[model samples]
Target: MSERPLNVGLIGGGGGAFIVQPHQRAIHFDGTRRVTVAALHPDPEVAQAEAAAWEYPLKGYDSYDDLIKQEAAKPLGERIDYALIVTPNHVHFDPAIKCVQAGIPVFCEKPLTLNIDEAKQLVDAVKEKNVPFAVSHTYLGHWTSRFARFIVKSGLLGDVRWVDSYYLQGWLAARTEDSGNAQAEWRVDPKKSGASLCGGDIGTHALMQLRYVTGLDVTRVQAHLETFVGGRSLDDHFTTYVELSNGGRGLVRASQIAIGHKNDLGIEINGTKGSLVWRQEFPEELTIRLPDQPDRTYFRGSVSANDGFLKDLPEELMAEPNIPPGHPEAFHDAFARLHRCFEQDVRAYNDGKPFECDGSKYANIDDGYMGMAFIQASVKSSQEGNVWVNMDC
Candidate 1:
């Protein structure tokens, strides 16, 4: 039976928020979900104004607290099915906890929260409330990302030896924050962005990509967090040499000062059998290299299970919803994939049925906590004279 579209409420995304745009498009991608209401800004007046002037019709509240209280009071069908928090780093914890306590599913933006302590609180809250929650690690939604996970975790790659997960950008190469760029302004501030700017922003994405693909945790880290731009309170370039739980070594790195690189996020994994490489710039394909053999390039929607290189493909993955092979799914598609998976869990929760918010479909609240722990470890390692530090989760 076809169901009505899931209603989603917005906690942030006012005053020219960049992340909110992709999320908006993604939520409505399948016609199964829609943003019905929003508390758009920090200021109550501005939030109401933005809602009133919104391109489409939506209910506006003075603040997230007001939005939460009123929405939670409604019956299941009338209230929002889930809430999407696109607020800054510092605003994540409060609203997310409130949503969980209110029996509302939440899909929050990452690094999760401003600090490890808040992340701990959120982890506990989600566990206690047992609500469906997700952290927005966008690239994980890519079809090729799931394909890579199948290849590595299924032992096609043999025992992992080394991996390099990186996200690079050049937009913040200069002091764009000083020039009245709202996004850059909060990002470079430690009070708002937490310990490390580059690490908290995109470095966590690299870390998560590595973890999701390799199915390994970073047990320890030797990091070098650097601030290339002068007068910045936080690091603009973040790098960490990591010890994986499976006895493998890897690097999780990100930089905002690498000129000419625009969202150049990619991952390369080296194993005893062969290697796998994926780049977001070319989102449609992944390259595989094996000893004394031809390099095989696999494109989305164009794979056969019984191929020698790939075997025992899961039916769920093969049956995952997508357009055609060469149709070219990009940023918005990736976001939509995440939200689509999230919607199922929300539906199950509302029906009082078992639902898995496990990392298999999308990053769960635990993944969000781990991201915070990693950043805290990396920052401590860098501050302690670039010494190795064990992750304190």
Candidate 2:
């Protein structure tokens, strides 16, 4: 028999919130999941009004606490299969922990929590409870990312030597916080955005990309978190010199003050034999460079096998959800893929089956913890005159 669609609930994402838009669209993309309820805002009246005015009928709660409390009281089939925490950096830990304690799976936005201690607490709680938890590392959903992972980890690129993982943007080049931008305002505040703004906001994405594709951990880091725009408490530019577990080296950097760059998240890896490059803006294709050969470029749906460069591509990678080459899959598609993979785990958990929270398809709780740990280490490194800090703490 075909199973019914999973009901998902939203925490936060109301009143002109940006991230939630992509999330809700992605939730609805496959018809296997739908958002049926939400605690839309921090204020009761506003939340209620937003829900009432929502495009579709939805269950509304004044706050996330009320939503979790009530839904947790319902019968299994009548309640949300999972909760999506699209709240700010400071708000992630509470609702996520609540969902786990209440026996609900959670898919949360990144940078995990405000500090390493809270991230650790969340990790321990999830482990003790044995719940399904996914951290939204959105870019990992790209089919090319998986292919890159296979190529690098399979030693197709020889021994990894250096990687340059970075995400750059021009949005916060000026003090947009003073110009009435809510996203800019909260992100620039340390109390709301954590110790490092640029690092916590987007540098972690770069780090996740490096770790995911190369299959390595940043064991040690020396960082310089800088603030280019005047009067900002948090850094707008983030740079880190990292030592990977395999004795390789790399740089995981992010900047919001770079003019003319919009969401320029990309990675280039150089190994003993050759190099591979990928850019989010041009996500459909990846470039491979080697001596005595032309640069080999592969598109998502147009990969060829038996070529000397890509001898035998994984069938599973070839089989992952995809459209034609010219159709072009972008941000929403990546988000949908993550949700789709997460849906499988949630369904398995619901049916009392063992699910994979192994950080393979989508990021697991431990990946989220590592992100926070990296941020703290970067901040400490910067504060102590840019000395190296070990990630293990």
Candidate 3:
């Protein structure tokens, strides 16, 4: 017989927060896992009200402390299997570390914590607790992303030379925060969003894509963080010139002031033999370019092993379920893939089995730490007149 569904507890995501909706949908995408409880808001009454008004049935708490403490005291089968922390950057470290210490697994949002020190502390806590921790670098869940990682790391593109990774958006171009936009308000505030707004928000996505697909660590960075919108304290534009571990150079850039763009995140890597490109806007396909051949585009559900240019495909990659090539698999589907992979490790943890939280299927705690380190280095590089700063992680 199949096991009972894994119970998920939310640590934030109340009061018109946009990111939570996608996460909620992803959490319940498969019947095997669910949002059984939540501490929805910072305000006690508001949190309770929101939970009561939640679209589905769930236990609610006023704060993450209550959620973690109360839920953790229950028996294994009855308590929350894992906690999903969708709080702002500043609130991340506390609840996450508490969950870790309480023997609860966590699936947290990006950029880890507000600073490198907090990130390091959280990392150390996870190590000591030995629990499953996943950082939601959502794009990595795309099948095309997995295929791209395989292509580059498999040496099909030869030794890497250069890369360009970027994410652009237009919503913050004109001070949407001033307009009382809940998402925009917290994001533009330096106190709440942490240092380097664009970098911490979406630039990390670009940084993670480069690191994930290429499997390379950024050793050093020369960065420039700028704010185009008149009175904002944090940057709306971020760019970094990075030195890769493999001796290649790359640009990881992000902008919120680009007017026409909307979530235009993409990457291009040029190696000795060829190049690979992927754009989240067109999430379905991955493109490959060889020296003298026409570009080959591979769509999800349309690949096979041992094709002329393709080598042996990993069984896990091939066997992942998807609709036919023509039918689209976009954002929510990508998120589901992440939660699905996370579920396996979570299940393993619950069963007292050895599980890998090793950056392969999803962004693990180490990956999250690297993101904070990258942000800290980029901010330092920008502040120090754009000089090269070693990523001393």
Writing each residue's lDDT as its tens digit, candidate 1 over 1-393 gives 889899999999999999999999999999999999999998999999999999899999999999999999999989999999999998999999999999899999998999999999889889999899999999999989999999999999899999999999999999999999999999998989999899999999999999999999999999999998899989999999999999999999999999999999999999999999999989889999999999999999899987888888999998874678878989999999999999999999999999989899899998999999999999999999989999985
Root-mean-square deviation (CA) per prediction? 0.9, 0.9, 0.7
Per-residue error for 10 in candidate 2, Å, reads 0.3
Error of 3 at 337 (Å): 0.7
In model 2, the number of clashes is 0
Error of 2 at 316 (Å): 1.7
Against the hidden reference, what TM-scores do the models get?
0.99, 0.99, 0.99
- Give the candidate order by descending lDDT: 1, 3, 2
Stretches of candidate 1 exceeding 4 Å from the true structure? none
What's the residue-level lDDT of 199 in candidate 2?
99
Tell me which residue pairs clash in candidate 1: none
Off by over 4 Å in 3: none
- Candidate 3 on 28-132: residue-level lDDT in tens? 998889999999999999999999999999999989999999999999999999999999988999999999999999999987999889998999999998999
Residue 127, candidate 1: Cα error in Å is 0.6
lDDT, candidates in the order shown: 0.94, 0.93, 0.94
